[model samples]
Target: MTTGAEPDHGFAWPDVLCAPVRSLPEHSRLWVALSGGLDSVLLLHLAAFCHRSRVDVHAIHVNHQLQPNANETEAFCRTQCAALGIPLVVRRVSVNIGQAGGNLGGVEEAAREARYAVFEEILGPGDLLLLAHHADDQVETVLFRLIRGSGVAGLAGMPRARPLAAGQLVRPLLELERAELEHWAREAGIEWVEDPSNADQGYDRNYLRHTIIPGLKARWPGLARRVRHSAGACADSEFLNERLAERQWTECSKGSRALSVPALQALTVVEQKNLVRWWARKRGFRPPVVSDWSQVMHDLLEAAEDREPELREEGFRLRRFQGWIHLVPEQPEVPVSPVTLLPGEPLHWAYWTLTLESVANPESPSRPIRVSTRQGGERVRFRPEGSSKSLKNWFQEQAVPPWERACLPLVFAGSGDAGELIAIGDLWCSEQYSGGAPAAGWRLVVRRECD
Candidate 1:
């Protein structure tokens, strides 16, 4: 029953839409994510009216069948798009909102995942996915992240534009108020479906939107706008942090992949912690809490040089060997025995596998190579001209940690009585079995690090 003439409200929808899309490249295929809601309806109408030819406005509605009238909602969206002379794509998805632990967050996250999956599948490269997120939603997100003690990245709320699989997603209405969108819809005589669950306080976002945000806004009329500003500031700080982290990573590491432990140890404790945290986030690992990070830095950098150091957090373990740190999965001590490999058979291990292939070379020495687990006492003669040295001494000289030594695959040559250690992969390779004359083809292929 709302009317456009109710009040001026000092805002206009046409201006809102034009402002964001003004800078967008002309003739861009814009896909508007329509939820059969007022905001999306207004967005579709405005885009169709303004840039019908230059911008190909397509509507996509995801039917999350959580209500009895889900089919009706899809029909309404299709009709609306048809009326606007735009193409409509309706997708039906079933959301499993169960009553298990983490079910509340899980349901929302799963629905988001499902929606994005569909979007990626349908959207072509260079297309723009437009979302109807407004300033109010950004405010709520900032508050949610604040309650969870999130860092700057979380507090920054959603970005206006971010890269997805095939295309980029843009939240054009993020700078506008929700009330302005409603006013625009009323002026255009647009009809939209009402989702009853939005009013139901069972969901956390609904609870905040209905009960908490209104209360806060009542006391301070521009509370949402102020929080949005704070989010912008946080986003700026986060950007600076990322730039600094990139520079520090380059200066403190030898390769593009991992940091050198000695270089990391040279920095102050604060710098080291920042570098590690930045590295973890860049690698797609969840950022640790402040306390957890303190512990991780202490264990990783400050531990005795000879002592094996390990730090475990959320299925990931960071361990130090010599002057290098590696992130790996926490492995249990599963008993693995050496099994003879046939010509085409692959020897599987916890982390890697060894594949042996035979090549033709008459000059190649016929030596028997036996694969076996380390038994704590074994000598490997690396070269035919060098004296035989204990495996322990070789690992120490190579800077391999004591904990990782037992896990390395040890390859020995010579049968039963003449069996002698020959080569190892990713650890140390014996020189005795290394040299061979090349014929048409002669090579021993061993695949290591297979679980």
Candidate 2:
């Protein structure tokens, strides 16, 4: 860690500037996201001088390794934190530039995602991560979203505080303008590194910051405050949209994981779209982005009964099965050929796990048990001495989705055509293989992942 000029304790800070940092939400520890920039450097000083005595104050610097002087900036952050007697953690991340074509927007987004991932990983309960996003940054963000055709949620701008991982992320300087923060930093004799990329107008944000915002500021003079008000209005609208979606979800849902097709068809197209987006977000997945929602909704809601229509998204898909729409996660590949299920060992198949355990004073099975996916002609015997039914017929009777039937594990007591299907995934198990005392003297336990 290198040393720098310490903050001037004698310089009096304005009450408006200090109030945001002083009146933080209840937290056990405070962390400053130090970027070695003017805004972040000033934020670190404010956090130290205002809350260091009351709570544990620390700093984290994420090195994106994008610019030529990335290492120098990281070193500067270390030096500043060391001078203030605050612990600093430096995380170096490799930003993937494969998606960044000729522009810097992709790189910016990738670095932001990586930085937030680090923050999410380090934050714990009662920890508050302080960001240095000022009013100027908010204006840029809102304008950028507007240019990109973003919805109300995107136009709402960065929140003042929100839950991140197990902790909270707070931007105390969001109400302060960039010029205000820089003026105070220079007044207190603080030092910071100037990133060279900020000067390049090649990046979209840089172009906005240097070319557009300056002119807007000169023309309006109160552009930041006006933008803040508009952003606040958008935020309010987005909140109401979320609440409306929640209520509509409760009305149309068939169960906790699915929606009723008939119930959804009764609602307006806009409501349907909003509910689906809200559901995907609630399940921790990005919402599906389609060129036309009306056509998608029509196919899902009004398609023929024989046709299995579905909307696929990242991580999960929404499929109309029977009378309900099920949100199913993409299952992993299962073994195509027969695999021996040894006693006391758990076998993982797709999203399901199969385990065979021997009962007390149990007798050995008549033959080796194995597990595999359905191989066309298959039979399942619910009883040891009763009649057997075809696997296809049983699945149809149970109303199991076709996509799921292809991956469900078929556990058998023997091999080939003579094999007796003892268990069907986690849905069914033969009496001989289940219960307190089985004819085979063993228990076949099957479990499916919750995700």
- How displaced is residue 413 in candidate 1, in Å? 16
Give the range where candidate 2 is weakest over 10 consecutive residues by summed lDDT: 1-10
In model 1, which regions exceed 4 Å deviation? 1-13, 25-28, 52-55, 98-103, 266-270, 290-292, 329-451
Specify the highest-TM-score model's number: 2
lDDT by candidate, in order shown:
0.72, 0.87
Candidate 2 displacement at residue 217 in angstroms: 2.3
Worst 10 residues of 1 by lDDT: 433-442
Best by lDDT: 2
lDDT of 1 by residue, 278-383 (tens): 8777666775556655567778877887877877667566788766777655554634765554444676655556554555534433664557768777887665
User: 1-451 in candidate 2: lDDT tens per residue?
Assistant: 2223465777776777789988899887898999998888888988887763634898999999988899989988888898899999899999889975545888888999999999998898999999999999999999999999888889999999999999999999998898888777777777888889889998889999999999999999999999999999999998999999888888888445579888899988898888898888888888878789999999998999899898989998899988888878888877768999988889988879899989854465667899988888887767667787888998999888888889999888887777778889999998887899877888899998653
Backbone clashes for every candidate come to 10, 0
- Stretches of candidate 2 off by over 4 Å are 1-9, 52-55, 335-349, 352-371, 383-386, 410-423, 429-451
